[model samples]
Target chain A: MNAPQRIVVDPVTRIEGHLRIEAETDASGKITRASSAGTMVRGIEIILRGRDPRDAWAFAQRICGVCTLVHGMASIRSVEDALHRAIPSYSIPRNAEIIRNLMIGAQYVHDHVMHFYHLHALDWVDVVSALKADPKATSSLAQSISNYSKSSPGYFADVQKKVKTFVEQGQLGIFANAYWGHPAYKLPPEANLMAVAHYLEALAWQRDVVKLHAIFGGKNPHPNFVVGGTPSAISVHSSSGAAKARGGQDGTAVNMVGLQTVQTVIKQMKDFVDQVYIPDLLAIASFYKDWGAIGSSGGNYLSFGDMPEKDIWTPDSFLIPRGVILDGDISKVHPINMDDDNEIQEFVSHAWYKYKDGDDKGLHPWKGETEFNYTGPKPPYEQLDVDQKYSWLKSPRWKGKPMEVGPLARALIMYATGNKQMKELVDYTLKTLDVPVAALFSTLGRTAARGLESKVIADAMQGMFDSLIANIKAGDVKTFNEQYWDPASWPKSMKGVGLMEAPRGGLSHWMVIEDGRIDNYQAIVPSTWNAGPRDTAGNSGPYEASLQHNHVLHDPKQPLEILRTIHSYDPCLACAVHVTDPEGEELIQVKVK
Target chain B: MSLEDIRVVVDAGESSPYQADALSGNAPVLLRELAEHVRQLMAAGEPTAIDLNALPLTPADLDWLKATLGEGEISVTLHSDGESTLAETACPGVWWVTHHNESGHVVSRFIEVAFVPELVKAHPEDVKTGLEYLESLIFDLS
Candidate 1:
C-alpha cells in the first residue's frame, strides 16, 4: 500500500480563469480530501456601490470575458426588476424579449462548442497520438460518425500537415505545458485526429456565430446593453431602401440584411450543432464510458430558468424551467423563492470573508457582505490551512445544503419538469450511449449535458428568429419600454434580483437601489455555486465533492483526472471571486529608483 | 435605454464612437515580452511565439504597436488554407504573422521571435512528398 500523498495543480490550464486545486489521496491512490480555491479576487460589486442603477450593466459586464453578455443581461434585468417593483406594468417590448432570447441561445451554442473542443477535449484526446494516425483512416472515421463535408482525406491530410509543422517547429504555442500522452487519455489515434480537426473547425465556426450578437447588440464581447431592453431597435425599411439616405442604417439597425444575416447565423449554428458538435461529443464520450460512474456531486441541483417568451417576470413562458432536485430523487422538485432569505444563503466559514456580525451564519445575497479577511499562508508558499480560511469564494447553499449548478443541473431540472423537447433529447442520448439514468449524475454526464442542451438551444434559436420576424411584420417595432424609464418615477428604496440561466449555469444578480442609485449589489454567479468551498456545516462544493468521489489518480504528478472533472464544470474564477473589504488604502505600492 | 441619456464619456479625435485610454494599452507589456523572447532566443537558442489574437488588445494598442515596431525588409505571403502574411518587424528576429480564413476573416495573429517564421518554412515531409510528385511526373514523361 502506498502512503498518503498530497498533490496540487496550481493555475489549472485551459480554463477560463485562475484556479488552484489541492487534493490528498489515500494508500490506494483514491482521492481522500480535496479543496478548491479561486486565487484571484474581483470586486465588481463594490465598484457599483454608488453608481446609477441604469448604468450598472456596463461595469458589471466586465466580470467575465468568455461569458461576456450574461452579466450585462443580468444587470439590466436587475434594474428592470427594481423598477417593476414600484410600477407593476413595467416590461420590455415583446420583440426585445425575443431578441434577448436569440442572443442568449447563440451564446449557449457558441460557448459550449468552444468549451468542448478547446477547453475540455484535451482531457480525453491525445494530440501527440493523433500524429500516428493515417489521414484516410481518420477521414473514414469522421465520415462514419457524421456527414460533415469537411471530413475528406485531402482535407484531413492538410490538417495533419499543419499539425506536423507546428510540432516540428518546437513551439507549441497554446498546446505547451499540457499533459500530452498521459495514461488516462483513452481515445484512439483516429478519433484524436478527427477531434483535432474539429477543434480547428470550431475556432473558425465560433467567429461567424458571434455575429448574431454583433447584429443585435452592436458588438461581440461585452456588447452594448441597456436597462429597459436590448440596445438596438428594429428598422422596418431595408438598408438599401430609402432609409439609406437617413444615415446608412445597414448593420446599425435591425433591417432586412441584418435579419437575413441573423437567419444565416441561426442556420450555421443549428447545422454545426447537429452535424459536428453532437457527433464529436458522442464519439469522444463512447470511448470513456467508465467515467459514467465517477464524479457525482451528491445529486443536488438548482436552476433559475431563463429565456422568457412573453413577460420578463413570468416563468410560464420560459424555455428553460427552474426547480431544485435533492438527494438524486427525480420524483420531487422543490420550488425556489428568490425573495426568501431562508431558502438561498451564502456562508463564509471556510472562505476568506467575514460578516459584520458573524462569519458562521449564512446571509442571503441581498444582505451578503464583501469583507475580506485573509488568514492563510502568505504568497509564495505551500499548502493552504484548509481548516481555517482557504478560498475567496463564499459557500452558497439552499436551505443549508450545498447544491450543484450548471448544465447538468439545468438538464435534470428540465427533465424533471417533463419538458417535451428536453425529454426527447435526453432519451435519445441515453439510448445512444447505453448509459443508465444514474449516469447523468457524473462528470461525463455534465459534459454530455452541455452538448445536449446546446443542441436544444441551437434548435430553439430558429423559433426565436421566426417569432422576431413575425412580430416585425405585425408592425411592432418597439424594443424599449419608457413607462418606468424616468428615475423621477419615485421609489425611495427598492430591492430586486435578476435571475438567468447563463451559459455555464444559473446566474443571479441582487441589487438594492435607492434614489435611482445602486446601494448594494451582489452577484452569485454559476462558478460560485459550483466551485465554492465548504460551508459551516462541513459540506463540500460540487468541485471538491466531485473530485473526492470515486476519483483515482494514475500519476499524482500529472493530475489529468482532476482536470477532467474541474474542466467539466467550465469553471470561471474571475466571475466567482467578488469579495473585497476595501481598507481605504492601497494593497500594493511600487517604488521607482 | 434612451439614447439621449447615454453620455459619451470620452470625446476625442477618434472617428469611431468607442474610445479607450491610450495610456492603458497592452503595448508596454507586449514590448517587454518581445524583449524577453529576443533575449531568450539569443542566449539559449530557443524560439518562442506569442498569439496576439489571444491577447486583449484594443485597436489603439494595435496601432501603437504597429507604429512602434516598424517594418523590416522582407515580407512574404503564403496562399495555403487561405492567405497568410508574415512580415518582419523593424526589430530583427521579430516577425508579425496573420492568418486569414477562406472568407478573408483574420483567424489568428501572432508575433514570432525567431530567425524565420516557421509557417514560411517547408517541412521535410512536405518536401519529400514534393520530390515523390516530381519523380511521378518524370515517369509520366517516360
Candidate 2:
C-alpha cells in the first residue's frame, strides 16, 4: 500500500519570528498546494489603541524583535505625518545626516551579516559535514582574505577543530535537528568548514555592532532611530563617553573617536562588502547560477526612495528618485504623495470575517480596525476559491499593481533618476563583482546589491562622520530639540506621508488627524509590501506570485530550492510580522453536523 | 451528563471527516477583520489582535455558536487515545470530535499560535497550553 503524502515543517528556526509551513502532496506526491502559517499573536495592534500619538514610536518598535528599527521609523513617521511636522532643513545638517546615516548603516551591517551566515547557510552546509572537512584548506581560505596568515593552525583552524569536536560529540545544537546529509550539501567540505567558522565570527560582530545603535538612539534589535531628527546629536569633545570607543576606549587610539566608533565599524563592513562579501557572493553565485530564475515574479518595482542630506530623517535630498517600473519597463515615474498617488483597500471574501462588500476600505494603521474572531471555521475565501484564500496578509499595492520593493528596486529607481553617486556605485560594483550590469536587475542582483549599497552608504557615512568631527572640532555641535512644541504647534487638519528605505525594503507611514489625537495612522511596512497576500483585485504579492514559477530541483525534503528563492526576497517577516485568526465559538459547545 | 462527561459523537466510515463548519466560516475574513478592527479600535481606543490559537469561552464569542449548535458531530484523524476517564465512558470518535471542536475554537481566536503535536513535543513549554486547552478537550461544562 502506498503511504499517503504528508509533510510538515513546524517552528522554522534561525529566521527570527514564528512561522510554520504546512505543504502537502496529493495522491501522486506533488505539491499541489501549500500554506505558510504564522504562529504567535501578541495582539500588538490591539494594544496600541488610544496611546498618546507622540509615544507611538516607542510602542510600535515592540512589534518584532528583529526589525524594531524599521518599526520605530514607521511609528515615528506616522505621528510626524499626523502632526504635520514639516521637518526643517534644505539638506539635513551635514553632521546630523551623517550621524543618522551611520547609525542606520550599522543596522544593515548587523542584519546582513547575521542573515548570510546564520539563517540561510546551514541549509547547504551540514553540521555533520564539518567533521569531514580538511582543516588546512579551510584555514587557507580564511587566511587568504584575512591578511593574518600563520603557518601554525591559527584562529580559523582552531574554530574548525572546536566545531568538529562538537559535531563528533553529538552536540549539533548549533544547527541541531537539521537535515545533515541532504543532497544539496554540494560544496567541498572545506567550504562548509570555512562557512561554519565565519558563522561564529559573524554572530560576535553582530552583537558588537549594537553599541552603534545604543550611542545614537537607545538600543537595537530595534534602535530608537528618529525619522525627522535623531535622538543623539553630533560632538567632537569626548569628556563623557557618548558611544563606546570602537576597539579602544581612550582618545589616544587612532579609531576610538566618539561617532567614529560607528564610522570605523562601517569602514570595516565596507571593506568586507567590497573585498570579501561581493567576491564571496560571486563565488557562491558561480555555483548557483540556476537560482537567478527561481524567483522572478515579473512584477513592477518601486522604492518610496530615501534622502541622505545633512538631515537624513527629513524627506528632502533623495539618494534615489520615486515611482514605478511596470512589467520590467520604466513607466510612470512620479513624486510619491500617499494621498493623490496611492490607493489601498482590504478584501475579506477570501478571509475569515463576515462583512458586506466594500465594508473594509484601506485605513492607515492608526485608523485601522483589528477585531478578534475565533473560529477555526471556514477559510477566509470559502466564499471565493481555495486557490485564492491561503495567506493572512492583505495584499498591499502601489497604484494597485504588484510592485517589488527592495535593494534592486531602490537601485534601479536611483539609476532611473540619474543620481550620480548611486549610479556610479551601481556600475562600479557590477564591474568589481564581475557580474554583468544587467544582473543588477534581478533578485540575486538585489541581494548582492543590498550588500554593495551597504558599502556605498557606509562610505558616504564615513565621509559625513569625518566632516561632522571637523565641524565639532570647530565648535559647531548641534543636538537636542528646540522649544518643546506642544501638540498645538502641529497642523491638525493637514495630512502627510513619510517614506524610508528600510533594511527589508521601502517603508511608508501615512497619517491624518482631527484635533490632534491621531484620527488615522497607517504604515506600509517592508514585510507588508514583500509578504503581502493577494490584493483586492486578485493580484498576488511579489513573493507570492514569484513562488509559483520556481522549480524545486531537489527532493522536497531538501527545500534549498524553495528557501533560496524565498530568502532572496530578504523577507523580514519580523519587519511587518504575520497574523493568523483563531477558530470561532463552536468549539466551546458540542455540535452535530 | 455533566458537560465534562458528555461524549461527542463523530460520523463513522471511510468518508471525508465530519466538517467543522463553524470553524471554517471565520478563517478567511476574521484575521483581516481583526487586523482592521483592532486598528480601528486602536483609533477608537482598543489595541488587540485576535489571538489565533486562543479560543474564547466568553459568552459573546462562542455562546452563539454553542447556543445554535448545542452539540454537533465532527471527525478528526486521531493522534492518540485520551485519558482513562476519557476512554472509559466516551466513544473514541466522541472524544476526538469534542477535542477537535475546542481545538478549532482555540485555533480561531489566536492570531498566531502553534499546536502541531510534533512541534509542541519539541518546544512544548513555549507553545503548549495543554492546561488552557484541557477544558475544551474534555466534555465538562461546569
Candidate 3:
C-alpha cells in the first residue's frame, strides 16, 4: 500500500466565484478523501442588520455578480412576505406575477446557456486542437448533428481562422490558462470547432438576451426591482400620435418593441438550446460516458420550488415543486418545510464562524449568525487545517444530512415527484446518451440536467410572455402594489423566508423585520449548500463528498478530473463569502498566540 | 389680423422643426468606423483600439453599437486596484474593455480589434517575479 497523496486546487476557475478543493488519493491515483473550502468571508448578512427592510434587496443583490438578480428577487420576496404577514390584503397583480415569471424564466435560460457554453464546455471541448479541424468536415459534422443556421463551410473556416490567429498571437484570452490538450479532453477536432463556434455565438446571443432584463428591470447585472412588483410600467403614450392612438402597445416601457425583443430573445434561447447546447451536451457526454460512474455526493437532494404559476405562497402552483429525495430513490419525495427549524439548519463546526450556543449546534436561517472566527493557518499556507475550521462557508444541512443541491437535485426531485416534463427530458437525455438512470447521480448527469432545465425553462418563457402581454392588452397594467410601500402600516416585528430556485440551485433569504428595519438577515445561497464545508458530525459537504471515491487523476498538476467534478456543481463561492478589500491588501492579520 | 389670432394647429408635445432637427443628430459615424475597423482586422489581422470615452456618444448610440457589433467568445474580469471587464464582440477580434473605479463607476471604456486586449495581459515583470519565486521555493524545498 502506498501513502496517500494530497492535491489542492485553489481558486477553481470557470465557475462564478472563489473555491478551493483538496483531495487525497490512494496508490492507483483514485481519490480517497476530499475537502472543500470557501476562502472568503461574505458579511453581507451582518451588513444588512438594522437597515431599511426595503433596501435589503439592493444590498443582497450585490452578493454575487453572476447570479445577480436571484438574490435581489429573494430579498424582496422576504420583505414582501414579512409585509404580507402584517397585511394579508397585500398581493401582486397578475401582470406583475407574469412579468416576474418572465424575468425568472429569462434568467434561467440565460444563466444555463452561459454555464453550458462558457463555463462547462471547455471541460470537454479542446480549443487548441480545434485549429487542426477541417472546416468542411466541421461543418458536415455540425450539420449531421443539428441543422443550426451557422453550420456552413465558410462560417467554420472563418471561426478556424479566428482561432488560429488567437493561437499564433500567443494570447488565447479567456481560453488562456486552461489545461488544453489534456487527456481528459475527449471531443474530436471537428466537434471542438463546432462547439467553439457556438460558444462565440452564445456570447453574442447572451448580450442581446440580457437586454430583456435591461428593458424590464433597467439594467442587466443587478437590475432594479421593487418589493411589491417590477419597476417597469407599461408605456401609455408615445411621441407619434398614431402610435399613441394604437393604445401605446407599440411604445416603450415593455411595449411592442420591448415585447418583440423579448420574443426574439426567447426564440434565440430556444433555437440555441435545441440546436447547439443540447446537441453539444449529448455529443460531449457520449464521448465521456465512463464519467457516469463518478462524482456522486451524499444521495440526498433538496429543492425550494420557484416560478409560482398563481401565488408565491401556494406550493401547488410552483412550476418546479419543492421536495427532498433521499437515498437516490426515484420513487418517493419527502416534503420540505421551510418554517421548521429542525428540518433546515446550518452548523459551523467545520466553518470559520461561531455560534452563540455552540459550534456543534445547527441554527435555522431565521436565527442564523455570521460571527467570524478564523482559526486556520495564515495566508501563503500550503494546505488547509482540515481537522479544524477550514472554510468560511457554514455547513448547511437538510434534516441533519449534507444534502446536495442544484440541477441534479432539482431534476431528481421533479422526476421522483412525477413532473411529466422533467421526467420526459431526463428519460430522453438518458436514452440519447445510452446511459442508465443511475448515471443521473454522476457528474455528467448533473451537467446534462442543467442543459435540460434550460430547454424546459426556455420553452416555458413563451407562455409567460403571452400571459403577460394578454394582461397588458386587457388594460391591466398594474406593475406595483403601493399599499405596502409605506412602512407606517407595519407590525412591530415579523420574520419571513424568501425561497427561490436559482439557476444553480435552491436559494433562500431569511429576514426578521422590526419596526420597518431589518433586524437580521441570512441568505443560504446555492453555493453555500453545495460548496460548504463539513458538518458537526464531520460529514463532508457536496463538493467534498462528490470528489470522493474512484476519481483517478491523470495529472495531479492539471487536476482536470477534479475540476470536472467540482465545476459540475457550478461552485459560486462569491455568493457564499463576498467581501472586498480595496487596498490590494489582505484584510486578515492573525496573531499566533 | 394679428399673428396670435392666426394660430397654426400643432400636436401636443410636438417640438418645433428646429428643435426636432437638433434632437435628431447625425448618423452613428463612430459605429461605421468601428465596423470598418473590425472588417480591416478580420481581413488583414491588423489591430485597432478605439477609446469610447473620447467619442461623442449618447447612451442610445452605445446600445446601437453593441447590438450591431455583437459579443464574441470571451469575457474576462480583472480585480486589482479596481475592477475591469473585457468582452469580445461577435466580430471575432473586436473587444470591449470597461474599467471601473473603486466606487464602481466606469472610468475608462475602449473598443479594441485585436487578438486580445492589452490590459488583460499579465505584466511581464510580474511573470518574471512569479518565475523567480517558484525557483526560490524549489531551491528551499531541495
State each model's TM-score restricted to chain B: 0.80, 0.22, 0.72
The residue pairs found clashing in candidate 1 are none
Q: What does the lDDT read for residue A23 in candidate 3?
A: 89
lDDT of 2 by residue, B26-137 (tens): 4445435545654554466543334433542232223233233233242234343331111111211111112223212112222211112121133566446765577566
Q: What is the overall TM-score of model 3 with all chains considered together?
A: 0.79
- Candidate 2 achieves a global lDDT of 0.53
lDDT of 2 at B113: 15
Ranked by DockQ, the better of candidates 2 and 3 is 3
Model 2 over residues A1-593: C-alpha lDDT tens digits?
A: 22344455545666656544444555444443444434334545444444456666776677667655766766665655444345342223355555656666676666766666777666556666766777777667656645422312466568777976776787666567667787766767766776776677667666657767766775666666553456664422233222122122222222234344555465667665655555555555555554444466564787776645633234456554556666766434555555543444333323323232242344333234433322332432122123544344445665666677877777677677776777787777566556665555455666666666666565665665666555655555554344323566655464555567776777765555555554545556676676665555666666655555444435656555556555666665544542322222433553312
The candidate, 1 or 3, that scores higher on TM-score is 1
lDDT per residue as tens, model 1, A450-524: 999998899888888877776766567788876777776748898888889998999999999988888889999
Candidate 2 lands at a TM-score of 0.68
Better of 2 and 3 by TM-score: 3
State the lDDT of candidate 3 residue by residue for B1-86, as single tens digits.
11112111222557422232333243267667877987887799788899888877544455556666788889999997689999
RMSD for each model, in Å, please? 11.7, 24.1, 14.2
